[model samples]
Target: MATSFNEQFDQHGAWRREFSLRLKLLAEWLKDHDLLDAAVAERLRRLEIQVRSDKLMVAFVAEFSRGKSEMINAIFFAGYGRRIMPATAGRTTMCPTEMGYDPEVPACLRLLPIETRLQPQALMEWRMVPEKWTRVDLDVNNPQQLAQAFERVSETRKVTQEEAHALGFWHPETPEDNPVSDAQGMVEVPRWRHALINIAHPLLKQGLVILDTPGLNAIGAEPELTVSLIPQAQAVVFILGADTGVTKSDLSIWREHLLPESDQEDIRLVVLNKIDTLWDALSTPEQIQSQIDRQKASTADILEISPSRVIAISAQKGLVAKVTKDAALLEQSCLRQLEDALGHGMLDQRQKILGSAMARGVSHLRCETERVIQMRKRDLTEQAIELKGLHGKNVSVIRHMRSRIAQEQSEFDQGGSKIHAVRSVHLKLLREVFALLGSKALKAEMAELTQALGQKGLKLGIKRSYSDTFDKLRSHWTRVQGLIGEIQSMLTAMFRQLNAEYGFALQVPDQPDMGACLAEMEEVQRSHLQYLSLGNTFKLAQPEFAERLVRALSTRLRGIHESALGDVELWSKSAAAQLDVQLRERRQSFVRRMDAIDRIQQAAGGLDERVQAIDQQIAHLDQLEEKLASLAERLVSAGDTVAAAQEPLSA
Candidate 1:
């Protein structure tokens, strides 16, 4: 039996909750030990939020009537005993629908007006302004009513050809390629540009977001669907009709929407859906099997992925099997296999990505704390060793020891001048970095690109201008990365000087990689480049829509820029905090040593007792160090349920 998506999602939720608890424990430990200052506390809060809100998004992209919606209904909503999403024979789910649960909001259906596309703001920006959406309350207890309410997503409006053309739904030059006007000069357009469904479904509640995308025409109409949403999904299940094989439209959707590399490591699955269409009574079981194999192999060859990556399944049959509780049909449908693939593939991939990121931050925090603890341990040991020698010493000898200690203190304090200089340079370098990555620079670049694109004409010309916007941001990142390198280099030299002078033993901070951010910027460019090819070139070729598209694309680029800034900002703060922590530790160590000497000077009654106390303190820190190490190890490795680098595309 395949592992239930519900069961797997629950497992992920359980794992996530446990991880959160551990993070909380780590935070508390840092607080209790006085390792968490305001900055550290803020970072901890962000980490917790990241863990809580992390979702495994799966995009089901395909041509019309490829069983994309049916696959979703079968894999997730079968327990409703009927299809929640209307998955009939024709083009249903006209708009791109996102299915997820947000308990903070009421259970409802929120639909963005199709007219919102006329505005310069993107769908992503529109999400923040809830008032723009048409809200319908969902009654989970009344499934029939809820299903009917959802049917609005597939509803279409008869728009005049001029209106449809303006919305990029009608193309007069390429009428055969997209939706065309009827004899009455009216074109059918999706009533809503996008749909947001919030439900109390178990899988959705556990942060599994299901993206049910419409066909290429709808995808082309809404550039954000292809540009931002689909590319960001943890996995994309490219559904194809098994009977139809790779149709022209299907191939177009694949190559166009998906920026597939030649390597099969991309987080995607090829599901040859509607295999039931191939089940002919005249054909033997062996013959049917042979037909399925050939199709899968042929799809793999054409798509240039490994053959094992292509999964053949009857989604229609799967839904029937699930709704009717027919085990044999369900097994034959291979819905369970797809479920297993998604569970093992997407969920686990999300875990690793999220876990690794969390681990980097938490580990850095732990290491800083551990360094302070080690310093405390070393101080105690030195104190104990000095006290042992002091047991039999006379007043003159004690005076000499105090003199040496005072001289050391004087030298350490004298380095304060050096500290001020290094700190001044550090602040200046940080200022330069922040200025380079400032929101002002980002806005200026976007505005410049938008103006340039708005002046352009033709699909190819406009696409180049759109791509130039991303390249501009990439250049910004490259510049920021160089500035960060300079910052890191300066900090390393300053820290090494301090380590030699005051014994901070600071490890030089690594410059955060802009590669990931740059790559994502490149991806947005590629997806939007395809967005131009959807035969909606005439629409985009318009100066107003062209400018609007660039402005909308700005939302995505802004996010990328902010993320890169945050990473660098965090590193800078961590680096400075490490120095402050060491300085504080050193000052405290001096105070304690002076107090011990004063006590011994006052009266030499219990020298052995003081020595023993210092030893015990050192021993306690040794135990604490072990615990801290264990905690960091567990935080990183906990819920590493996924194995390393499995052939993800394989069945």
Candidate 2:
């Protein structure tokens, strides 16, 4: 199981390097030819970072004692010949644990204090601050020491009900949902808010992120998990215990968290774990198989997913099979099926996402360069034609052509002033768009809403805050959309005027799609409303939780603001880049024409030589184009080969 995913990932990474190499080749060529602009260079650098730092986020979500940790151990840490995560018995993972490799960070486990949950700041913000976490250096050579270090994730502390309630764990209204209190009236809660483990594991190095989420209590307390983390993961694995089947809590977790949006694909895998528990010695093997099949079908019907998405696997047996090298038990465990599904789904889906993003950026950069080079080629052909037409003509013909070229240069210089005026207006308008959508703008809006909402009742405050905030945000969206339209309209007019007057074929760039960003804002609002509907009732009533929820949701909305700003900036710049490339190419063409005529006038019959010189430049551009085509082909084909082998995959 490890080998298959590892092989696919290694192949993916190798070819990804090839993609980077091709980009480097094109970038160096552009730099050498002085065709690279700020936009193109920035895009090239972004693609480089993306290719080098791509990670597939595969989240394992399940209720407690669903063998999630065991499944992870079987699939990822089986090579260790022992359990890497604390999967000994009931609910070993007390908090959310993420495992991955980072060369920049040393091999260690970092735990954020559970006490930090009292703060309004989110886990994401805390993650950026090193001093806030308790870091434990891992001794990889010693597996026992490593396992002991992992135990910290499951560590718990006794806290009073008041403290737990303040930490957003205990609920007075839902006493059944609260943790059991001891004789001293103290509840057991996770000592840490989150765990981040950095290991030198090969799969982690291959860019596989393993997210191990705890049961309902821990997950419900973390708003970031639902609002950001889980949805963003490339693949999700929802495990269920064969012993308990889909218990009420399990159903709650599934319906509330794992359930997909209507438009979203139902890609999450439902693993019927602990299947070995169903093995009946008195019954025949066929009877046992019948029982397992029935369980799987029943689970599928209940979850409203196809039966094919549910895989019956014994994580404990699989782990043992792997450690003991028992092929028969390993096959019976059926971990391979789940592994293949997860491996292909995560790696391939992530590959497509990475490919599409890079393709957009790379294509934009390449096309811009191609446009400049193509224009040069066309100008070269014209220069050759102009020179060749002077076969038997006198010096007066050459002088007339030179004067016309000079006039054309002056016309272009005058057009430059118009281009500058448009660029100036575009930038001024872009600043207006940014002002409404920037982080500071979002913060200011949130602060005012927070202050105003505080005066209302808890329920009213929650509803009104979300309604008012999103309403104002949508207004900002409308304004940004209008400004973006104005910018695009202005640029479109500029492109058309330039083409009509200068005989250029400049296409107007499409308007920036602020729709996707706006939809993200809508998603956050929907989830917040859903959270309210799903009965975070008591949690919302509390001032701390109310404030935390606001801050968490606000953070996401603020991110969208900043993202919109950058995106609008990039789109506006892209349009300007196209114009700049064409204008420079046009100016160079006039220079080449004037130079060709100057050479002819200086010599007694050098028209043929001058035409030959122009022909050489045309041939050079042909080679340049061939090289670009070859590089582009290599970049696309690098993933195409690997992608063809990837069939339907899941997690």
Candidate 3:
């Protein structure tokens, strides 16, 4: 037996819930590790927000009277035993409508004023101000209240040609196709710019958001709908009448609006709706089947999608069948297959999106952190090797250090004068380095650098922004180079003095190359400039430029600065530590020599215990290295699980 629509929806909900939980867990892990930096964190946070807030948006698009609303009714609202959304024939759903559940807001139908279309802000921005919309309370269980409130989508207002133009309805080239004018030359337009119905339904509250959009005129009038909302949806169902598949208006809506959306066909499902219209009273079953097949194939060809994607379904009949508990009629309506397709195809893709986010947040961060741990482990291993080598040659080295200390002590006891001289040199070098390239100097300059990038004319001025930001970064980089040279010179001189005075071998490491650092900044700058230049005409794109550009610069500069500081600090500390160790050896050398002769007598008896202790430490480090390696494997395995779950989404 085929699955019921309710069962499919429930399964979809279950899968989504599990996917959401996994994403939340991944987010928590990333947050704990402090790896969710601003750049990578946004996508992870969006997934977490969508899961927690239940905002998986699915859109239905079609020309007027294509049974798009009916499909929604049958698949989702049929459980109510009647249509919950308006699906009446002949120009129903005049405005674009959205159905979702907002837990914070009361269940209601809110309509934005059509006059607001003249404003420059996006529709999402307008939603923030509740006073801009007309609200009507809704009780979900009450059919009459829902029916009454839903009628607002079909509400119309008479407007003159000038008023129509201002609302984005009348273009000079398409004057003839404008809404049929009355005797007074007044055209009718939708009274509401947009309608949002917040329903208190389990599926809606379980992360199912639906967009029910109208035909060509409504879509063309709204730029935000085409640019932002539709593209962001998990799936788009494009409905067409089976009897008249892919009409001119339908094609227009598909090409002009839906086609431009990202992952157009990948996330799109074309529905040949109103298949009941093709049923003939006298024709044989085979003839009807052949006719429907021909329509599906032709529609697929017209839409440039596979035939398997063009589904035929009688949504009106499907609603009646499900409500009346008629199995045969329900099967005949073909709604079950469509439901499965949506449940498997669309819901699966949604799950993949969540899974991908989890992999990014968890696995990517785990790998980066593990890499740092591995580096530290390597450094520790080197230190351990040095200790082992020193232990093996302890007798001979201590004898030589013993005689040198006796000679030094005769000259001066405690070596206080030598220690003070070394410390003085280290302090002077540190002060000079901090003065030039300290965090204070770098941070103070960043504000002015960012402001210079943001200062522009009425246009985005992408070229000027890039030029100024890059120049500032270059100057900062040059200063860092100069500081590195100064530090390098100080270290070379200081190390030479320590070698001559204390007879220790310590050398300065090569200065970090600024070329790679500069290249990274240039690359980020180019990407930001490219993004801003592409959509410079849109005011919405302006804020993104400022936010992304600053973030890019800050992240790259912070990385470079940290690298420079690490290099300089590591070299300086290593030199000071080596000097101090030599000085301590000089002071303790004679005592250790006397003690070494006694220790040799004692070790002659207890040598085995000491060797055993050394062996245990070696074994412990080996175990630790193995454990870290195993952890890296686990991280990879966890990432594979998410990828495996995503595999079926493409099918």
Q: How big is the positional error of residue 435 in model 3, measured in Å on the Cα after superposition? A: 27
Tens-place lDDT digits, model 1, residues 485-596: 8778888888887877665678765778888877777777776766676555667566567666666677877788788778877777778777777777788888877778
Total backbone collisions for each predicted model: 0, 1, 0
All candidates: TM-score:
0.91, 0.92, 0.60
- Candidate 3 stretches with Cα past 4 Å from truth are 1-55, 260-265, 368-651
lDDT tens digits, residues 1-651, model 3? 557645765665665555555555555554564333342344445545654564667799888888888888898888788787888878889888999898899999999989887664557667789889999999888987797789889998999987887777766655655787899989899999899999878788776788998887776666556645675577888888997778888887777545643432237778998888889999988999999999999998998888998889999999999899999999999999888887767666655555454555444344433433333334334333433443545667746644654675676454467657756766775666655556665555555554555555535455665576568657766765776677677767866876676554545545556665566566455544544453323322334334333543454456566756655564455445444444544445435334443454445534344445445745654654454445434433433454433332210
TM-score of 3: 0.60
RMSD of each: 4.2, 3.8, 11.6
Candidate 2 residues lying further than 4 Å off, grouped into runs, are 1-3, 32-35, 358-363, 389-404, 448-464, 637-639, 643-651
Q: What C-alpha lDDT values do all the predictions have?
A: 0.80, 0.80, 0.66
Worst 10 residues of 3 by lDDT: 642-651
The candidate scoring highest on TM-score is 2
Residue 86's lDDT in candidate 3:
86
